[model samples]
Target: MSATQSHRGVGSAVALPPLSNGPHRKRLGLVALIATFGGLLFGYDTGVINGALRPMTAELGLTPFTEGIVASSLVFAAAIGALSGGRISDGWGRRKTIILLAVLFFAGTLVCVFTPSVGVLVVGRVLLGLAVGGASAVVPVFLAEMAPFEIRGSLAGRNELMIVVGQLAAFVVNAIIGIVWGDVPGVWRIMLAVCALPAIALFFGMLRVPESPRWLVEKGRHDEALAVLRSVRSEDRALAELGEVENVAKEERESQQIGWRAVFSNKNLFRILLVGIGLGVAQQLTGINSIMYYGQTVLVESGFNESGALIANIAPGVIAVIGGVIALTLMDRIDRRKTFILGLALTTSCHLLIGFASMMLPVGNPIRPFVILFLVVAFVGSMQTFLNVAVWVYLSEVFPLHMRGFGTGVSIFFLWVVNGFLSLFFPSLVAGLGITGTFFLFAVVGALALVFVVKQVPETRGRTLEALEEDVTTGAIYLVHKNQG
Candidate 1:
């Protein structure tokens, strides 16, 4: 039960515990459903702008430059939220942090709905961004810590599924409101207002769910941790897992490697942080968010009129939800490394096809818009299916328990930063390079991402978080494949 003993056992075979059924399983399912409301809010807040932007531009007099500012301001703030939210969650506890985020979400939504000018709207978005970023960093970790290793992938992945579902809801609502109230002034406010309902739900929901058992253990509240664990796990398995967690937690405390200082000074911790950051960066560079935030613009450039593009944008959102469902089913069955490799390959190919279609079909061609739309949908579907959920789940589980929050927060900060830059400049890129040239650039970036995954990303599937933590902290994770080969 010592740290040395646990570290030595990292390479040994450890069987996954059987999933418990009955009330305990239902309790776990309900917790996942409630917590992922954060993901839902993240999706709706980020995606609502896709349809709302056109009408908002007309009413608010948003020049192209100012439009970029309005769109990306939330993303930039999210980067700040993500970096700080992780550390805050570590100190404040995951449950309390999520409750605070819910309050932010509701307040931010109200601000956006009521704001009369561009400046006020930007301020409102910054508030929402902080909540979104915090949820991105915290929700998956909460789910992962709560789940049994047997179903951790799917359970944690539900947050991503909820995210896409929220995005789809935004798209559907935008289409309904935009078409129905096409003549109504400030219809976009209604679109922004709908998210407040889920924010309220998340607040109340967190109050009912138990704090993460692993987090309770980390704080040295052993009896409480076991109590929470028993609600979701079989009693015998709960006790056994508690022992494993305590052994690792003890070693982490004894070593005194817990925060940013430890991350920088320890070579293994630093390498893994880089890997997490790399994964985050790679996911954003796929150019998926570019479509999510500006699908209407992209479709317009491909030849659809503004109204047509607004409706057409729903295609990608629908495909994204479907792909997320598919990905969740495969999460536990497939190797994490294989999912990354295949996802990168598929998404990169889709990018190339979209670029070529734009060049070869031309804007005036009758089929051009439809072709581009199809390719965009394919790109989104591939990303949702293979990259999005898998990346979040991997990031949540890859770090040592002591530094999980810091590592996840830092990695997702880079993710949001890349996404913000892309959102900010996508208009300029489209205006200058045209759809063909812009997507070609994304294709090139996608190719490089494929290389990064094949070379640097480690396999995390089918391992307990503690075992994975052991390998990650000692740098043994990188050598596992080679030794097996």
Candidate 2:
């Protein structure tokens, strides 16, 4: 092909493919949707704890500190899960790894549903965390590799969309259970047990989806990779993609040493890892999960009762899904760096709004709940639309083929660790400092994260993964300093 033709083909693969009229394209889209249920389960489990904790605390007699532990233990374990998940996916294949995560999800949900003590509950949560971490690290990679570059952003983005959907699912389910079965001593168990249903769906779904074609190439199964790619893409497109994957694999093996060590040995790789971790940590520091995982309780403490809080929490979930839809539309249009920086700025302002609202509107004020809840929704909307999908897509796309797993694992591990710590202490922070102080702290972190993102991150939109990898691996992005220094 001529250079112009080659550029066009690569562009089609990278941009979101326009809605297709063909059966094959439709089939591929459906397959992507089905496989993304893993993302859904991940979103649900993490968010369910937000509302479930209220009843779980009462039943389990959890102190504020213990409640923090219960909430955060899974986050800590998820870091382990994200780290280990990469190696496992690299070896077992993405499909098998997802199936394994489904099993963990089922078992963890069962443990939590039946547990009589807080220790057992925490154990179940840790197991669940492992699955969450693994899914977070692997699912986006799986989707990205499987999707046509044309629609890759939106298709790979579907996982993030499912994440918000899952959160919405959790909010809806928690509300129904809390309101209808509010009198039950252990209603929280039922809330958690609901996760098992999706776990079952995800397990069976994985059995049907093919392994990632890029993974097959990494394992030297080029024929198999091409076969898998052909199922989702045109024959010409599949062959082209296969060549790209193989070329990268060949160059990667020549260096003969590609792993987490490469992250440190190569300054460029190390810089990419730092950027990845910064994105993950910054995404968390926005306190998105704090809202998703604890929104109901926050609403309750702000003055709404159990039923009112459950009903009110839906606002954020609704906005989250809406934001995700908006993100899907903008994934290809907005520069990734700008979206993230904009997200931090908007979310920081929301935090300030929330803090000020909480402080100005006394507990007795009827407007307190609406104002705080609306601001929380605004925060969730801004985050889901910008940072959430962009970070995952960038992580999945930026790394070279050989070290993709390790790079993603390192990034997500720290992401989950921060998430875990935040999950653990946020409630206590809220308890001790009240909403104003807690949000003030988030605002400060948000500002700091904004600075880091603006200075360190690079634009990744409209570039093929291979092109991005080439730029990243060669220190091309940072080469401007060659003359300056």
Candidate 3:
């Protein structure tokens, strides 16, 4: 065994070995680019609706209640998608699962682009939702399983970057189409159609990428796992890593009581899964999607004209992309728990400030909209910078290799469900409660989320997946990092 040095934290010392050295940067970078196309599809499909919805409602003769349903339909389907996709990826392998998602993306976009009725359009959105949910569940794990421990954060976080970039693409596309062809019937279809080109690219691109080696080992394909590992790591390191992985897989198989029953029967596995669920639910409760989904309405309610709100909506998307970039740079450098806590803190504060500003400023004040907009943008920046990437990375890493997909799926299922319900009822929420009330509600949730992170979330930086897996399987990973510096 490698020599270990004792690192002191608040009340204990952890003798952690050095993290695995990074592997071929160029090889891994290319793999990330291919995998993250799923994220792009995710961002575009969800966000295109942001700008496209206003025109869509007018064309479809949608009631406000129906508007919420149309918006939430994709999200509800995404919940199912994340659940099913997680299980599918666990069985089918991550790379193949992603390829399937690409096909769904293409078909979903095509359906939405041509749908003449509300019913058909919803079916398309649900298809797109499946693609989005699958991408969200699998891409991070794909990257995580491929990455070296030392740089896993940055490498895995590229999916979040791609997601936000896709969102930004939607915002920009919606703005262009809205400006040039705003009055044209079915311009919204053009916005939805933009996703199809990338889907084709994703399908073709993934054909050349390798499957996750850890998953290969889990399936008893040791030789195949070694072969995949060699392309990403030095030959000697690849062999060493394979040896470690084989040992774990053997222990898991020997223990062999797996499935939902096994997961619950094992206390450590169940506890960690709950933490993952908490993280997922907490993220959505921040209310970030409300802005992404109903931003124009929020902006208009804050006083801007519809045209101006469409243009101004781009600001949050721009900040989201920029925040994603900054987040990618910081992931490997910062401890995961701190980033999460800081994100929740900032997000919560923004909520309170937004609520307070809206109340004090009231309606019709020229500065009220601008101030609330600024706070909302600030909240988006905080979330994209700290919360989004870290939460995804944490979900990818916390589960045992045997159950990574299922665990992440269940957690994210709840996340998407929370997101869906919020999206579904947000128009109602705003109408019932208005900006001040809605924001204060977010503020309350944000405060509780802040506490959850500080008390429950574990730090996962600078640790090998294998090492983390060992600790997690034993319940030590949770206890060790819960208070560690």
- lDDT tens readout by residue for model 3, 358-445: 8899788999889988988999999999999999999998788988999989999999999999999999999999999999999999
When 1 and 2 are scored with lDDT, the better candidate is 1
Write down the TM-score for model 1. 0.97
What TM-score against the true fold does each predicted structure earn?
0.97, 0.94, 0.95
Candidate 1 local lDDT, 211-277, one digit each (tens): 9889999999999999998999888778878888898899888888776788988998999899899
- Tens-digit lDDT track of model 2 for 113-181: 899798898899999999999999989988887875556678888899999899899989988998889
C-alpha lDDT of residue 17 in model 2 = 26
Candidate-wise lDDT, in order: 0.91, 0.83, 0.88
Q: Give the candidate number with the greatest TM-score.
A: 1
Query: Total clashing residue pairs per candidate?
Result: 0, 10, 0
Number of the top lDDT candidate: 1
| Model 1 / residue 325 / CA error / Å | 0.4
